[model samples]
Target: MTEPSSTPHATAPGASASSQTAASQSAADETPASQADFRASARRTFAIEEAAIAALESHLDDDFDRACQLMLATKGRVIVTGMGKSGHVASKIAATLASTGTPAFFVHPGEASHGDLGMITPADVVLALSNSGETAEVTALLPLLKRMGTPLVSMTGKPGSTLARDAEAHLDTSVAQEACPLNLAPTASTTAALVMGDALAVALLEARGFTAEEFALSHPGGSLGRRLLLRVQDVMHHGDALPRVALGSPLRDALLEITRQGMGFTCVIDDDDHLVGVYTDGDLRRTLDQHGDLRALKVDDVMTRGGKTVRASMLAAEAVRIMEENRISVLVVCDEDEHPIGAIHMHGLLASGVI
Candidate 1:
């Protein structure tokens, strides 16, 4: 019987992901502007949006400070509301604020006019985004907001418009022109609004002195959370799974321990159960190169004396740094007395998303 060789096909291992992606992209491009230089058009859009965001610096005034102070002093949540494209940017801003220490959530202007207006309170602060500052759905909520005595902070292109005039503070997010050729789409205007929203959230974050650990608490399930919160002991192999052998043990015993634990290395411990050194696969190769008498070799002679170690309480990210700086793939987790309680390998760090 003969095993067939894999041929170069779209789904085969021989066809790499890059090749598949290129094929799909070329096949799926059905643009009407195929004759136009797409990359050059993209560059122009970037330039226009960049100018819009940069223009905001000149527009900053006491209104920006008033907006920040209003949100900071609010006892209840920051209620973010918008319509159409502005709604999408408002949703993201609310999420950023909530995660960064300022509690906030988004409410659609149309929905707010319905029954969701009941969700707002006198202690709450309302952040409204409308490029025209006169969006019917948004402006409809202004009278109710004033009646309830809820402070309004607005980001609008038109400073003289109704929404801006009603707000306690107005952030001018006006842009010179739309990046769209038709000059109707909310291209540069939306970018300016989003950047202004981020400025507000980050300003609030610094005012609150938000810490990374607190940020991790808000995002407890992602790779970022693991990087910020996971300790060396949480990811290291411990107890019986920890690979180790006596310091004076024969090199073959260290080899057996490494193979049994599948850690590619083994800790060498003295009779008092304290780690004295470590023997790795690299050490094995070096030992074989330097010593012809394999039978006479001991772990004590071949091992790296007092090999690099980390405390169990150390951060997993710090452990990764040590591994990178030392050019090693593994580290022994030692106690105050330098006794090996556990071990960590590069594979474990990668698997735990701490790498």
Candidate 2:
């Protein structure tokens, strides 16, 4: 028997299977038109998926709240399981949840029957995905899951399906149709499942009061964590590496400090080791414009007094903001008494992946 056209846009209602096949073949032969068709198909598919997601907005009801609460209250991780395309979606959802402060991991249904089921614990929650809701492998484990006292949340199109009926909570991810021309491939359904997974992850994230710092902790190896949690003191040059000059020091001597530190600037301090002012490359340029005798001028004479500085506790990102706002490339990190302890350059943020 010939299959029904998955799309409503087919040329004619009465078109024979052979005729449809010929048209598809002919269309495929025209390279430019084939590309256009593929683009149009993908665009339509995205629209359908977007619509599927939008449809979920109203469905974010008491069930969603309960799901978030369940996940948050659980002591163990979330175990996501599915078959076929849903397994792919589950893997991504698990990764998203893991990175966003929700402890989660994907468990394939096929693998579960082969002994991976040992991973499930009573403290964990199972998030099962199957469009038909009747996936054999997934359903076969339902009894074991129940025996373990693990709560199940199912995402499926058929609300009456066995998986849905057995689940403690069911999330409807049914799509009206698929983006595939044949309506057989998993397209819109998978999109809906993925979006719902994201929604759940985010809701749980907020309910748990998960902060960016918590998220950063989970992703410490990436640039994101560096930007969000790294401190200026963590990357700033400290100790003897810092270039310092006394207030009475000659400009030529201060220049030697800048050169030895290779920081393009030097801090001018008082006899008490308290920072009095800063002398930078900009100061050197301006001083040169004045045609002053550098050998005779004191460090304080051309220094920029009360320059912008940051605390050691300040985030590196905040330091970047300060630098950008002041139009400067460096900052002197100071103590409570206004004594320079360390220095950081703008490029340091870049090198450390904070920018």
Query: Which one is best on lDDT?
Result: 1
lDDT of 1 at 133: 99
lDDT of 1 at 243: 95
State residue 154's C-alpha deviation in candidate 1, in Å: 0.9
How far in Å is the alpha carbon of 74 misplaced in model 2?
1.2
lDDT of 1 by residue, 1-355 (tens): 9867545453575457778898888866755676579999999999999999999999999999999999999999999999999999999999999999999999999998879999999999999999999999999999999999999999999999999999999999999999998989999999999999999999999999999999998997887888899999999999999999997898889999999999999998899999889999999899889999988888898899998999999999999999999999999999999989999999999999986
After TM-score superposition, the amount by which residue 42's alpha carbon in candidate 2 deviates from its true location, in angstroms, is 2.9
**Which ten-residue region of model 1 has the weakest summed lDDT?**
5-14
Cα displacement (angstroms), candidate 1, residue 274, comes to 1.1
- Screening candidate 1 with a backbone cut-off below 3 angstroms (N, C-alpha, C), the clashing residue pairs are none
Q: lDDT score, residue 178, model 1? A: 92
Each model's C-alpha lDDT? Answer: 0.94, 0.89
